[model samples]
Target: MTEHRCPVMIVTSMPYRLAVIFLAGLMALLAGTLVARDAHAQPPHADPAWTDIVVGAGDDGRRLSLTEGHRLVIQLPANPSAGYLWQIEQLDTAIVARQWSSEPDYVGPGDEITGGATQQVLRFVALGEGQTTLQLALRREWESEAPPVGVFTLNLQTVGPFTGANYQYTVPPLTQPPALSPDDIYAEGLPTHFSWCEQGKCTPIRDQGMCGSCWAFATTGVMEAVIKIQDGVERDLSEQYLVSCNTHNWGCSGGYWAHDYHQNRVPPNEPDAGAVFEVEFPYQAKDVPCGAPHTHHEKISSWSHVGGYGLPSVAAIKQAIYAYGPVSVGVCASDAFGSYKGGIFTTDESSKCTGANHAVVLVGWDDGQGIWYLRNSWGTRWGEGGTMRIGYGVSRVGWNASYVVYGQTPYMPIGGATQPRVRLFLPAIARGGGGVAPDAAPVPTPTPVPTPTPTPQPVQQVPSNGGFEDGRVIWSESSQKGWPLIMNTGSLVIAPHQGSWASWLGGDHNEVAALTQSVQVPSASPYLTYWYWINSADSCGKDVARVLVNGTQVDTYDLCAARNTGGWQSRGVNLGAYVGQTVPLQISVTPRGPVDLATVRRFAELAFEVVGLDYRDYVVQDARFVRPADVDLLVGDPRKAKEVLGWEATTSFEDLVRIMVEAELSNPENA
Candidate 1:
């Protein structure tokens, strides 16, 4: 219009201007994306007032004011496949409140199998004005002897207002995977039926009595899933362990599936959950207070939240179950749910099962049936024999689901690095296998023995091919029920006292095995010599081997309580009495203790029942008509002790335990 400026400079500037505008817009878009990512790196309630402590920072102690909270960000070097886990061992809730914990953010240097790590932000708020200590431990939950890898202790205080605000803090930007859409995960295909139970990866069905402790069972289910998915090991995790120790839930009064799954939970007088076996902490219907933590067999490293507590997508729920093993979910249990048996249950949309009242395990899903599988805790007598099937579109079940991770490395809280599992491949062959396997060394067959020329040889070898050097040639070995003794044990460590090959006579209690051979000692001084080893190994073991010569027992030996690698023992007997005679020689070994799991478990149960026996009524009244004075004599033992040895007993053994326990109950401080 201005007749214009068609100059060469103006013509080129148009394209340049457009390029500049495009670049500016692209940069702004990238900047916004980075900012959004950084915002999510921190916990939902990250406050400047809260102090940050890197988990492995060798934190000795710290102080906090009653008016502020603190964050303990742990960058755990985790490998769940190894069954390692981290847990909060000690924390006094009387002085501090474990506010929340975020889902683990896994970050690998490259890939998962090669190397990877996890980041977790655990938030804690000081409750009242007092001093307390927080402790952490890392270990494998399933092992009985696996020691903790390390421990982290943080001494704290809330006695006064802020004093030292000079410690500058820096938070590492979290390396987190992007929020995944369920739709994206399911774009390919969904399995018809995917139950961990079908794969033999789930634990046995358990009952929760009359208490509404579905949440505890759900927690254990997820834990079992984690163990199975990560390590391909199906462990019967203790639901009773969580029911008694996890204080975050209301015990038998109930717990929530969506609540923090053990962020600050600690075992009483112990280090962590899964510390005790189910047999040790049997489940009872009542809301009993926690018992003293004993020898724990399982442990966990940390746990995570899936889709959070509210408004989670069903797609996300399904994706989580696929990625992690099983998931703990919340469902609205209604009148219909109480009577639900076997069938695909779809809540009548007009009247739905509404109210987040029950918790269960989201073990699997079926696209054909359009339902999700729920493993219930109401015993095998109810529902689909302890499992339920629900519709897919239902919102209640997907609302809030969680997952936990396992840890194999041990934690040394005093600032020690994690170590590989110590009890690797240490399964006790005595558990079920008939014969014990060699502990360390593997034994193969030795060189075969050839027959000598038929000369006037006075004595044939006492144990011809005893070491199985020629593969069960002369010695015939058999166990209870005609099971063959393990003749393939070629381990030098477990070999005969003399040779490299040895036979193993191993089984549960009450099972007997024998090795016999016929020898013609047709000469003077017919001496018998052999090498043998025996071990009871476990509390349930009572192994024994006997030397029987011609139906007469010459000597007997008892098995030690463990793998007796103390070298084989040698024994020799002079057979000069039976010179120029042929006799039957037999070596019989028998497992005279508990035979199976049921039998082994009975001993512990019997001990517990015996300890809990209440015989107080006998002290005041006579119920037995025969030999009642023995009871009286037991009642008068204190007087007798006073007369003899000047014992002047303070109390009887039973009375001492009862009185001590009573005194502790009256005054908890004594405990």
Candidate 2:
């Protein structure tokens, strides 16, 4: 195993005076003088299983089939009317048994007197066998532990063992993951705050309008943080620059932040001239055509994926957020998510998850309080002052997290990962599952947007939302979901180098994710150019990213780029030969190892002969092949067929000459 050393906290976005003061106050709070409040309803030395719920938030209908030894937990929102919290009322204690539990662990700074948000957690395990209902409710006193304000019930079934995929709505049934083993300074502390208020690196929340452009908004958030930390200036880079122009993205419909920030190395539509100022290319929240270069010249050096799939700990997320400002994240956003008002907004499995996709930023996490401070793009009208304090493990907040650094530098894996294991990051953006977006709210810009002269015509447009935006609109998948390629390995993210989205194609063993689309070229001199980012854990992975034109292979890039020029690279191919030909364009990637970024090296921005081209979105299906029937025949390679008949067979040579050979051999009269 490689030693994971913490990066020196050398780059402080603020002056030493401010940093020192913040550090001092936090240190004092964590000192021995810090008081540990007594466990509210439950005793202090409770079982570790007492707080096992880690993924799903608080919905009651959550399905569960816990294994014999595995633990289970239930967490709910609490209202503190005077340090008042909820406790377990009563249970059968037969089929479902309580090992231990805890009252709401409150953590807001000064809201105790005003009844701020609180979270109540309880732990349980399957007693013997059958399924049963676990019911509980709120009460002011602990002795009674009953007479509920609102009844929260969930079914608990004891199954053989957990084998199904962990599909969590909120925090996926809060379960204890492995412990945090990091070198971060704040890894072992209490009440660690990394919000914009504490670090001054994060920017104010901005609305993404009625558009599902959270990916772009999240990307801008990370970029804003990177600029502040590197140069001490906060710039609200243009999401509009991402909305339009980024050919791989479909503007408002939805997009991936990671690919938009890193993968689209060579945008076929417009030039990437760094992060544009807000005034230069302001947000319209609607899909608009590509526009000219807006004013500012600020651009990111590069961005990279951080953290592993099933990321081990909350501390890991906090470490990166503290070190790199706010990090972009994707979560399972539900209608419950849309109507969140205040406190640590939690999730449950009972309510129909109206919206399954969303992107946000993790500004901070409070260990002492058991909550994650999230900054949403829905403007200031939602959550607590435009932010929400969510229970720590809610909705994969820190999962698939990304961070940006200023200036062009080589891209690397998150956690400064140097292992040789191939990584298959899943795609980060998709839409249509939109719940009602908060109505328009004024977006306050702390930084001034600059207006500059713009010029230059855009290159011709091409079909295929190659970026995989628009919810698989232009392309179709050719494989089944249980296949290796269908795992969580490849994912859409908000880290594109140019647009707000790009496709993620992870390699899989034996199975292939063949995404194909058919299009007719509109004019002559048709050309193909695209941007791709790569990552590889080791050199042994067979995952490969390929570009195929007309069923013919054009080029292939592997996950080994981690050893080469290092980050995103753009390549071009002359399509003059097929300029007027209608054909299917296939972009396929497959990985079979620890992960191979064959792992999502997307083909974005198809630039070529512009004009109306007969195009069709094809559903990606597994490349199916049929077997040949048995025939007592043998054939020789007939090179002379081309000379005599002036023809060749698109079918196999064996099939073409099978009948001729059988007839000639059976003609005894010739002998």
Candidate 3:
């Protein structure tokens, strides 16, 4: 027992040492766990602890918050007067983030920063835990008239358990760095400005979706503009005829300019007979023989090709601009430009010139800096807000390289000898009123007076306040903001083939009827013709819809015969042709195939007074297919349509669905 006790005592020191070591290790582990838990609990960059403030134009500064792991996103309107500068700062002490001044600064063109208003996005991450204050500072760089400077500031505070998902990252800021100083041009620049001019336009090769018809789009765009300036009236030349009927060139895929011009002899003054009336074939990326004859004849005031020598210099370009508004030009393919928004240039690296690419117009040049301003076709989102300025003199990016220019020549000018007026062929008059007589005249009748006149009840007039009623009525300027009450009972809807409704099909029938909530047509005039769209299963025949205008039946149509199916289909119908005069428009459907009648769909847009209005306005409005909420979110904050347009949703989604269902159920065919 004594020996065992002694042995245990000897080992006791070791056990004590081991216990101390284990205790220390345990303490270290506990400390690490605590630190990790603290780290895990931290919120995202936009957490209240990391936030500052929120501010916008005409908006009060307010506190904003971020849930854990999320950040905050802010949008600001671009202001050039103040160099388009927008800043966000931490209220504690430091300037956490600032646009323009910060790294990767974005400085737009002086004009953009001043006169052209655009959208700008800014993002911030939560820095830490607790309440954080944010401050916003905006400066207008263009207010040179008033002390040359104006500043606006807003402050906000936010609390956050921030998550990263809450905020979108702002694009790295752009800097309006000066272009490289000009140098002398070399022989390599010959192709750049072969036909350069200050005022010239370039029409992009229209991507006739799915149709390998870039050649036709290019040809038509140039010719259409040419004809317009020549005739003093804008004419929509036909690409279909060029693609289909031109004999010497490939129908689709790629074709040269000379081949298209020579092979396709566009007739003059007969646009409707040859060009406008031709039906568009389904656009296909691969070449297909011109399948069918265009209903309209090809028309041209005059056509010629003018080839020139080496690239035109800046002076030459300026002269062209002074002479003509804009001229079209062609340049080498610089990049994989799926689309572009600004002016044209010859450089391969668009990133250097503010992201410009192929096919554009040289609208004007600034003599002060020798910069060539180009216009692009990709709407208005690309380039310097859809325009670009390139260095002119030294052939920067090959501006002096060989290029093609198209404009109205002396022979093509309005009222020139070569120009001819278009003559329309009206349809033969038909008998009406049950053929009672060929020319019935009113019989002479004697007027009777002095009969006991009953006291006439006083006619009451409702005060003519500017508001829309639920029932169908002619659109008035007062009700311009309301939803359109007219319905498309026609066979097709005309929209940019790229529009959202291009593929929209109604229920099972080849007809679709959307809620006529608060849409407005161009005007209330009965003579206005509107375009609509439809599709067919086969090329032979397709029934689109049954239309009733003011309780009278309208003709049915085979959609395939009238429009292209693979691309957007457009058909214009004179509403005045139906119901003897334009009145309440109602539409229904009857099916042509085994598909559900209710599932058939189509799209449409109204064209009011098609004569004088620019088609661009209609195209722009029709192309905007964003949902109402989306439009409001993008266009402006606190959208004013409710007050300005007097628009409000009178029907709910459930109610709309119910009405559709009831309509379907009421139809014996659907049942």
Candidate 4:
């Protein structure tokens, strides 16, 4: 306004002033936007103090402490399609603020079923330093007057500001037993029958569910029993911590006791290096990513093979069980083995012996009955209240016998508290008045047993075409008029994960395709296992894949979220609950929006072409990048290459792109 300059100068200055004002406004807008975003954002994923509480993993009635600004994630099973949805019944907003809740994008085999059982994931943040209670109810909205089918409650305490501190509780050490001479150690004689379980020294039987994590259960069971016997205190160590946190062991897919016990650490016997408590890390029965800054509550001083490799002698196993509380051993766990309800289980030629496929604990022995008492992980409904009697040499009952001596130091939470223990009562045994015969010559324990068994019922097999290799012989399909989306054996475009055939369910928009088969579930440990691949062109919630049992949705896959499977993923569903019933198993795919078969095909071809592979081969057999890492910003600079390596590209940009596409297609990873 004060400018009184030449006409040309005045015009130039006006434009300059306008530019400055425009830049200032933009700066102010950006600053305000950033402040608002920061205000509403939740804690970053990198936050070390975030806690994830998995419901049904024994998280109920537990009190948890968190510092202000920390996050808590609660996962609960839900079936919204069946009119059962989870809702917050009560929450103290003054102390804790609800962020948001949504359904998970992917359902794994552990939770997969036909009954539409999915997970509802909720997140909350501590707002102020105070105490509060979080409660949720699962019920139908229309039936508000009725009681909820399930309820979940958690006690939460929000401490002051975040202070990165190790909150630890020191376990009062027990009085060490006096060392004895060799003669004194051998003074005691073995008994005719010995059972830590009968003496109330054993932990409750745990159900591994559909997971093949018997090794972890067996390991933790022995640890719990030993802790009780040595310290005169019962402890429920976490099988999940061993399953998930141990890098040397495969979670839920079977593992070796030697590897988990000895090789889990770098140098062996690392301080505070052992399994956490069950309440701190509950059993999920599936692979979960190991969390950061994990704390161990117990450790083992030593573990060794009882009889030095192969099948140990029955006497050595008995001695180990007597001296070491409980011992872990590998078993065959055949279909017949699961069906052994009572009496000594013995194997015949029809049993089809393979090798040790499952792990269990040899809790005791009854020499009079010529049987060994084995504790199982198949829940209280199986065998004799989650235990069974096997003849000394049956089903490789004592192969790979190993015992662990617990470390004297046990850890507790910062509050100097231990989680409450849940005890399981075993069913009473009906014994005859006559006792067993005296100890006989020690014999080698049984060798390995047959595998792929189910719960205790007669083997009611899955559909003959469960793998989808016989075309559609035993399977039925339904789809839209033009899209025939079902299992394929003829298409070279999408190869099967295994044999010569597999199911291909989605291609067109606004289309629904499903495959169905009837399967008879066994009475015990019945489960269905299959492999699947997801190649989706659409994002999450736009296209969906689902598994239904008897017309009820049990599992669902969000196309976009599951796209990262990269290749065939094995999934299983437990059918033990549906014993003796033949139910329909259905896999269905529904695509929404304006997409067509041609578009889907084109997208797939383009994606696979870059790797020089057919879509099926790239997905099923040739996954180049197992998991691609993310970078916030990545840019290609030809100048850097020229300056650093003194190299210049001769190929044209267009031709380079074409060559890259061909190279990627022919790559072995995409073969």
For model 2, how does the per-residue alpha-carbon lDDT over 281-369 read when each residue is reduced to its tens digit? 77887778657745446665556556654333566676666555667776544334555677445453212211224568887775423
Candidate 2 has an lDDT of 0.45
Tell me the tens digit of each residue's lDDT in model 3 across 353-470. 2211123455555422234565433334445554565544322222322222333453212222332122111111224643212233322222323223233222112101101111
- Structural similarity to truth (TM-score) of each candidate: 0.33, 0.35, 0.26, 0.33
Question: Over the stretch 428-469, how does candidate 4's per-residue lDDT look in tens digits?
Answer: 112376322222222222323322222222222555445444
The Cα error of candidate 3 at residue 428, in Å, is 65
TM-score winner between candidates 1 and 3: 1
Badly placed stretches (over 4 Å) of model 3 are 1-215, 247-252, 258-286, 295-310, 317-326, 335-358, 368-408, 411-671
lDDT of 3 at 562: 30
Q: Judged by lDDT, which candidate is best? A: 4
State the lDDT at 385 in candidate 4: 80
Query: What is candidate 3's CA lDDT for residue 599?
Result: 9
Ten-residue region with minimum lDDT total, candidate 3: 18-27
Decoy 1 TM-score against native: 0.33
By how many angstroms RMSD does model 2 differ from the true structure?
28.4
By lDDT, the better pick of 2 and 4 is: 4
Which of the two candidates, 1 or 4, achieves a greater lDDT against the reference?
4
Residue 325 displacement (Å), model 1: 0.4
